[model samples]
Target chain A: MKRVLAVTAFTFRELIRSRLLFVWLISVIVLCGLDFLLSILSFGSTLQIFMDLGLAGMEISGLLVLLLGLAVTYTTEMDQKAIFLHLAKPLTRGEYLLGRILGFFLVNCLVVLGMGLVIVGLVVFLGGGTVPVLFYECVVFILLEMFVLTTLGLTYQMIATSMVGVVLYTFFTVFLGQCIGEVQWLLNQQLSHWVKVLLRVVYYILPNLEAFNLKDRLYDPNLVLGWAQWQDILLYAFSYSFVVFLIGWINLEKREFR
Target chain B: MERTAVVTDSPCAIQIRGLSKTYKTGFWFTPKVTHALKTVQLDVYENQAFGLMGLNGAGKTTLIKLVLGLLRPTAGSVAVLGGNISQRGVRQRIGYLPELPYFSKQHTGRELLGYFGSLHGLAGSALQHRVDEILDLVRMRSAAGLKVSGYSKGMLQRIGIGQALIGKPRLLICDEPMSGLDPVGYKEMRDIFIDLKKAGTTLFLNTHILDEVERVCDRVGILHEGVLKEVVPISKILESSVPVDYWIDVDGAEAAKLSGMPFQETVRNNGGVQVSGLVLAETLALLTARKAQVKGVRPLSSQVEAYFLKAIGAQAHLNRPIGGRRP
Candidate 1:
């Protein structure tokens, strides 16, 4: 446990010093600015459009931080061999993976939450609208989604030899995970039996990112986020994260640091 | 060409038997396996400064990584500190300084040590004191406050040693510890090795520096092409290599007589003379028998590099039957 905390703290500090947080701040500003401008240019309800884009802005910045975080750390840990100082010690491979995952999650949480607050403040003071309670719910779901992606990203870092390969694997996984819902709709179509089987397998295999896509349904009056729904979503996130974390741990143990 | 065992029954700090590593690359279906380390056997005992010498691509680093539990051995076992390398507590007791150590530039030397100390379950005052102690041991007390980016190559090496020493480990594995240091820096490192030895820390050093091995090591293990060629004591290697040449400063009157002797080179220097020869005792005895007053007798430097080269140089010593001779 102590080893995990130490790695967690050190990895967090490494991310901060790598200027990843600076990148996050810059992303928040640029993304929110782009959303604000696009909402005003559109003909629909500007306020609702802005809120929708703000949530989109949050997800974009959040995902961006995690993806970039994995790349930056992969370079430092593998290419630069900073991992020597850590893994050479008594810390177990599992603890090291867990700690790094936690570190990545914390940094991602900061990016999403920091942007959420800024957008909320902009809506209340300048956009002439009160921040809805549902917006916070969307933020919570976005946090959970970020958790899953971060774990998945780190899992790839364990298996991929090159930094570029790790990044590519993670980006493709995020794309497939985001497309699972649309593919589910296709699963119901009049496709061949084998195609449906393959689609069904892909749907079940990939994380159901749509389950945590609360931001897309924020304006839907029929949408509900009661205790039961929260339990299911959180349960799915934790179980999936646990499996990914285990895969990364086993790979790390098997890896030979040349 | 004979290799001698350390010849001690004491409990070993590190024990390896038939260790090998094969790295797999390429696509899953068509895999390429590179044999990084072949079957190698070595043993190092407590408080002994053992140096592992090898050239590039010679599996020196691979062996060290195996001991540190960073790489899994394909067909062997490694035990450190009377336990398996996989044992968690063994790592806490073993410090490592890797070749060309690179750390995060944002941390100061002190901060880096403190951070590593924390990983070893150190905290607060105990960690602080240990950090300070290692800093002083490596002579980095003044530079401890400076960021790692501001450090010179030598200072970086020192801090790398400092981090390794921070845990107060019983065994230290230093890989290529003297690869990039100047003369002064090497001297500093050499002194630290001696100090650590005196403090009862067993050291497992991997390097290509034969001079360093001669100076600081108790025993030396030469590895070539992923094979263990020989294990011999440093003191015996030095004792075995006959001095190539010896110089003697003699009196003026004895110069001409010394010049007439066979297998001796005599140079007239002012009123006196200096005689040189390949064998030290023969020349000294001849001079004394000839009634030449000997002013000084000094043996030349060591020939460790020669022995190391002869041991690992295309002799196929690794393929020779494993036999033991006393050093």
Candidate 2:
């Protein structure tokens, strides 16, 4: 556990020094600019628009940091062979992968939470409105979603041979993952047997990102925040992450540095 | 020539038998197979510096990786520290420095050392003390706080060696440790290796620099084209009567006497004759009997270099004439 944390801290320091937080700064400016413009143009409540845009900005910022971090680390650790020293140590390959996942997740957390605090501050101070309780729950859900994506991204890093390949694989997976609701809708419609089988395989394979997406239904009067829903989402997130982590660990163990 | 194992009393730090690595690349139907390492045998004893000498593509790096468990062998086994390298305890006792070591640019030298030390299970004040000691040993104390991105090549090599030693490993394996160092840095690194050897650290150095091998290594292995040609002690190579090239300086006034002489090659410009060690006496006698004034005689290559060339069957490729006949 100490060795894992050591790698985690080392990786975090590396990303921070690489100036990854600059993405958060740009995100805050854009989020505020978009919030103001959309609120002025829309006829709905201004606070609703503000909070909705803020949540979106947080997710987008987290994703940008993940993709960019993957590229940067792949160049140093893979292309430059910096991982030789780490693997040469007494640490196991699983520990290294876990540490890297935690490190990437930590950076993503900072970016997401930093943007969340900014939105909360604007709503309470400038708009003179109380923030909804669902906003906090949505933030937690976003963190869970980030954790799942972090595991998948690092798994792709292990399986990929090039930096571009890692980025593209994670990018397409995120896109398809977000379309789970539509795939479900397509399933309900009449379809060929073979096509339905393919859809079923993909649906079970890609992460059900729509499960953690509660921001869109923030104002729904029928929405219920219950213990059962939380349990299901949490279990799905962890189990999926564990499976992906195992795949990554196996790849790392079998990899040859030559 | 077949490889003759060195007879040593010390236990082997690394033991290899029938080890080979074959890489398969390209498409599946038409794969390209490269025999990087053949079925070779070697033993690196403890508490001694062993040098593996080879030309480019001679499988030196392949052999090192095989011993370290970085690459899975296609055939055979390697025992490091009397145990498998895959074991954590064995790895904890080993240290490795790659050729032209590269580290993440975002870390300071001190931070990097501390991190590696922690991986070796050192923590708290012990880790800090070890990091400090290594920094001082590598002569990078002043630059320890600076980021690695701002370091020079020599500074990087120092930190590389520092990390390798932070674990206090019993076996130190290095690939081209002297590469990219200035003369001063080279001497400092050599001094460090000598100190490590004195402190009871087994050194396995893979290098093309013959001088470094002669100065530091106790026994040397010559590898060529994926074959272990020979393993001999430095003292044996030094004492062997291997023929080396020599240059005899003569008086420029005797330039006329140099023509048509039975010497290898005569330099009329400097009134010098280059000859092999085999005919040095005969050539000097002829010069004396002819009343050609002899000024000085010097060897152009070291005995180790000549022996290495001869072991690889590359003597014919030497530029000097053989048996007093011009190539």
Candidate 3:
């Protein structure tokens, strides 16, 4: 446990010194500032405009922060061979992988909270209203969403060497996960019973990112999240993360550092 | 009688029998097999600095990696510190500094030491104490707070040694520690090796710097073409090839004549002469027998490179079986 904390702290220090945190900060500021301007110029339904712009900004910036965090965390250490120093000691592959994953989780959580605050502040300033509880609920779901995204990104980074390859693979999985609802609707229109079964299997296998989207109903106080629903989403996100983390950990254990 | 047989014990810090690592590179065309190490046997013991001397691509690093359990042995067993290399807990007492130690550039030297120290299971105040002690030992106390990117090559090597020595390991393995060091840094490293020896650490040093080995090592195993050519003691090698230098105060003509003697060279200076020969004792004896007044008998030392070349050359000539006695 001490070893885990030491490795994690050092990893966090490295991420900060790599200028990634600054990038996250600057991106959050710029994207939220632009969202504020869009809310101000909005003609019809100021609340609707603020909700649309704020949620869009939150989603885009949140995904960027997670992907950037994953890319910086994994690729930089690999290129520098800085992991060699830690692994050469008495550290097990599992400990090292857990340390890095936890470190990235902490960094991305901070990014989510920071971006959430900025979007909330912009919503209050432009729409002249207090932040709603549903916004807070969306924030929690986005944090959970980030956990799944970062783990999948880490899985891709483990197998792929090039940064572009990792980004493309992660983007593909995320896009597929996002479009599964639409694809399911389309498949329901003209499918035999067997085809429906196959599409249903695919839908269950892939992530249902649409469940995390709450922008349209965020202002409706009646749309509050209950305990059981939040628990199920959290469980699914954690299970997916665990499977990807296991794959990465096993590969890392068998890897020979030449 | 069936239960009375005796078993011989292995006498090495690491022992390997018929060790081979065949890496497959591709799925077709025989898989591009590379026999990195093959059928090698060696022994290293306590209080001895053992050198694995070889040129590049001679499997020196491969052998070290296998012994450290960084690379799995494909065909044989390796026992290090009396424990199987494949076992989990034996590495606690071993310290290794690889050919290239990759440190986080953003980590200060102190933080790096603390990080590695904790990995070795040292905690809190104890880890911090060890970090400070090792930094002082490696002469990096002032630079402890400096980032590694600002350190020079020599400073980096010193810090590498510091990290490897944090546990005060019983078996310390250094791979190419002296490469890319300046002369001052090389001498400083040699001094550190001697200090570590005095502290009772058995060193397994792999280097192409033969001179450093000759100066500091007690025993050396030369690996040539992936084969152990010799495991000669330093005392025997030094005694066999001790060089001699003498100054003959005789006239310059006699000095010139003395220079022409087989295998002798003369350096002239006004009325005196300085002569160097392959062996000083034989030359001194011959001069005394000839009634040539020897002003002084001084000894000269040969560098390890010259000594290594001569030794390898002589071994090549002595390869044949003995034909007859010198009757």
Candidate 4:
């Protein structure tokens, strides 16, 4: 556990010093700019628009940092062989993968929370309103999503032979993961048995990101905030992440650094 | 030197039997199998520097990676420090410096060392002290605060060695440890190896630097074409009757006296004549007798270089710009 923490700290320091926060800064500027523009153009309930846009900005910024972090670290660790030194240490491959996932998730948290703070500041100081409880819940959901994506991204890093491949795999997974709602809708529709089976497989395989898409349904009349839903979401996120993490660990163990 | 006397009796730091690696590449149906390491056997005992010498594609790095558990061997077992390398405790006793070692450019030398030290279970003040000692040992104290992205290749190599020694490992395995160093850095690295040897640390150096092997290694293993050809002591190679080339600098004013010399297989260049070690003495004697004013004589290659070429059956590669291969 100590060795895993060591690798975690090292990876965190590496990403921090790589100027990843600059992406957050850029996101903040873009978020503020878009908020200002949308405020002028929208018709009713500017607070709803503001919170929704702010939540989206936070999620986008978190994802941007994750993708960029994956690319940069992949070039250094896999392509340039920086991983050789780390693997040569007294750490297992599983520990290394876990540490890397935690480090990437930490950076994503910072970016997401940084954007959240900016949105909250805009709402409280400029708009003269109290922050909504759903806003905090949205941030937590975003964090859970980040955690799942972090594990999947690092798993792709383990399975990929090139930095471009890692990025592309993670990017497409994120895209398809967001379409879980549509896939669920298609499952209800009349379809061929073979196509349904393939879609069902993909549904169970890819992360149910739509479950964490709370920002889009914040104003839903029938949305429930019960502990049971929270329990299910958290359990699903962790269980899915655990499965992905295991695949990554197995691939890393079989990998030969030739 | 005393430890080297009993090196054969010492327990093996790394023991390999029937170790082989065949990489399968290309498509699955039409796969191309390249045997990276043939079924070979060798042992590196404790408290001695063992140099593995080979040409460009001679499986030296493959062997080192296999021993470190970075590569899975197709057909063998490696016992490092009398334990399986897969165990964390076994890895704790080993340090590996790959050829042209790279680190995350975001880290400074100190932070990198501190991180590696902490991985070895050093913490707090102990980790700091070890990092300081390693920085000083590798002579990177002043540059410790500089980010590795701004470091030169030699400085990177120094930090590479520093990180390898941070844990004070029982077995230090380095692939081309002296690469990318200036004359002074090279000397410092070589002296560090010598010092480590004296301190009873087992050194496994995969190097092409013949001078480093001659001055540091107790025994040298010559590998060729994924095969371990020979493993002989440096002392024996030095004592062996391998004929090395020599260059004798004769006076340029005695150009006319060099005309019909009775030396066998001697090539006269502009300022000197290159000859084998066998004819060096007789050529010098005849030159002196003719009053040709012999200036100086120097061996063209080290004994290890000659022995390596002879073992690989490539003695004709003698004049191919030594140091085994260009990295």
Candidate 2, lDDT over the whole model: 0.90
Q: How far in Å is the alpha carbon of B28 misplaced in model 4? A: 3.9
Residues A1-258 of candidate 1: C-alpha lDDT, one tens digit per residue = 887888778777777777777888888888888888988999977878888998988888888888888888888789989888788888888998999988888887888888988888888889878877889999999999999999999989988999999989888888899998799899889999999999998988788888888888778888767899999999999999999888889998898888
* Model 3 regions lying over 4 Å from their true place: A45-48, A55-59, A69-76, A125-127, A182-208, A215-217, A220-222, B1-12, B26-30, B84-88, B240-327
TM-score of chain A of 2: 0.97
- Each candidate's chain A: what TM-score? 0.95, 0.97, 0.86, 0.97
Instruction: Output the lDDT of residue A126, model 4.
Output: 91
Model 3 local distance difference test score: 0.71
Give Cα distance to truth, residue B149, candidate 1, Å: 2.9
Off by over 4 Å in 2: B1-7, B251-257, B265-268, B320-327
DockQ of 2: 0.83
lDDT of 2 by residue, B184-300 (tens): 999999999988888889999999998999888889999999989998898899889998888888898887777767856546555877888898999989888889998889877
lDDT of 1: 0.83
Q: Name the candidate that leads on DockQ.
A: 4
TM-score of 1: 0.87
Q: Which stretches of candidate 4 lie over 4 Å from their true place?
A: B1-3, B260-266, B288-291, B319-327
Runs in model 1 lying further than 4 Å from the true structure: B1-7, B24-34, B242-301, B314-327
Clashing pairs in 4: none
lDDT of 3 by residue, B24-90 (tens): 7877865787887777777777656788887788788888878876677778778888887544466
Worst 10 residues of 2 chain A by lDDT: A19-28
